[model samples]
Target: MSLSFDVFWSFRSPYSYLVTKRLVRLVEEWDVTAVIRPVRPLAVRTPDHFVRMDPLWRPYLFLDTKRTADYLGLPFARPRPDPIIQDPQTNVIAAEQPYIQNLTHLGIAACRMGRGLAYIDHVGSMLWDGTVVGWDQGDHLARAAAAAGLDHDRLQAMVDDDRDGCEAELQANEAALRAAGHWGVPTFVFEGEPFFGQDHLDVLLWRLRRHGTARRSSGEAVDG
Candidate 1:
């Protein structure tokens, strides 16, 4: 038997990057598949969200993400050219986002091509790992695409040709996400059950075990 789930993910969430690794491991060790649903960050989707957020929310999130990254040995840092250009003083997300649209489109294209998780691992690592400055410059994206077993030029061409189609699909993904009773990224839905957040991986695994998610024939769990 095989198992699978839908992952509602965003390009800007640190938690999404953290969960991608674990999701990859699950699929590699078990007879499972991850249906990727790429979504926009809340800051972009609902611009007023930040203004209404509690003052402590941003700071607490920063502190928690750093702590978690350290524990997992994953290098963490803010993107050099942030996907969303926000006003630091007011926490207002800019109306014109130059980066996220392109990145999200490419991610969607990868998912359409059936290698979404691989693409997420490759690209998400570069952004979250904190070492690549000007990540969108030079061959950074091209290299990441290649690493994920996707053709950089080919994906880019698809994105350029059908931007509207891609956006429509992404909009549908958001609808499905909300219908699942969660708006956050990294939400995994299995058998109509929603498992949200990185901390819930163990819980998700427990549920999978109960339902008999098939493991590798060799029966060893390896972190990829």
Candidate 2:
């Protein structure tokens, strides 16, 4: 049997967006499966995740995330309208959020259809690539969904009707992530070990290699 890892991901995390560029490669180039477990970003989950964060943290994150995107040659833009509605001055989050809930639910539905990883790569690019003015609007998500081989209509239908189950799944994911010894998105948990951050993908690859995790056949295309 092949090895699999749990990806604790959040749509609101730039790191989650940044990491998937290589993550897509990881799955394609190696022998492994990534199970996507979408979690509510802390802004939506606790409302204070960013508010209570260090004063210098948010600014540095913005600077770092954009530059990192450039470093990786990935397209990126600050989310227009932002995922969670918040007061920039006070970091006070609002209660009536429309975007994140819909996105997270569809993400869960994608996982159910076994296309979660692809959906994230495609859809996350739309959300973070700064190419689309409103990533959630019009044909943006639809195109992303199609690129990932998901039926957005059906996914939304499932999300609309299965609120309780989706929340339960997200809650379970959060609990499992905490149990794995981290409370961060973009965490890859393999064989009960938690590898956190975009920087950890290489280390995770090292561990996978050392442990005899499967490799692609010769000349199979690392980026394929």
Candidate 3:
């Protein structure tokens, strides 16, 4: 049987966006399966997470993520209309979060269809590639869904019809992440070992290779 790893991810995390393409490459290159588990962002999972974070943390994260993106040769930008609705000055989270809720639910639906990685790769690029403004507007998400081989209208309908079910799944994903010994997005867990950041990806790859992860047959083109 092929090895599988659990990916705990969030739509609001730039780190999650940054790690996705490489992850796509990993799944394509190795005979492994990614068990994509979409989780709510730290801000949502623990409302006080950002509130209690060190004052310098946000700025450092901004600087580091951009530098990391440059190092990886991927376009980077702070998402416009940042996914989490919070006061930049106060770091106070909002009560109603329509954007994140929608995106997370769609992520759940995509994962159900076995295209979760592709969905995130496409949608994450849209939000973090410094190219789009007002990412939630018009048919932006629909186009992204299409690019990931999903039907946006259908996914939306599924979410609309079973919002509670989706929330339950997200909660389960959050619990699994915590159980895996980490609270961060883009965490990849293999055999109960948690790799908690984009920087840890090389370590995760090393571990996977050590476990004898096989290469895909040459000429097998990777999917987007």
Q: Pick the candidate with the highest TM-score.
A: 3
| Residue 134 alpha-carbon offset, candidate 3, angstroms | 1.1
TM-score of each: 0.95, 0.93, 0.95
Q: What lDDT tens digits, residue by residue, belong to model 2 across residues 122-206? A: 8888888888887767888889999998888888999989988987888899999999999888899988899999889999888
lDDT of each: 0.86, 0.84, 0.88
**lDDT, residue 196, model 1:** 90
User: What number of clashing residue pairs does each candidate have, in the order they appear?
Assistant: 0, 0, 0
Pairing residues by index, what is the TM-score of model 1? Answer: 0.95
| TM-score between candidate 3 and the true structure | 0.95
Residue 73 displacement in candidate 3 (angstroms) = 0.9
Question: Which portions of model 1 miss their true places by more than 4 Å?
Answer: 218-224
Q: Candidate 1 lDDT, tens digit per residue, 1-224?
A: 66777888888999999888878888778876778888988899889999999999999999999999898888899877887789998998888886998888999999988888889888998888888899989998899999999998999999999999999988998888888888887898888788999888878888888888778886443321
Q: Which pairs clash in the backbone of model 2?
A: none
**Pairs in clash, predicted candidate 1:** none
TM-score of 2: 0.93
**Which should have the higher lDDT, number 1 or number 3?**
3
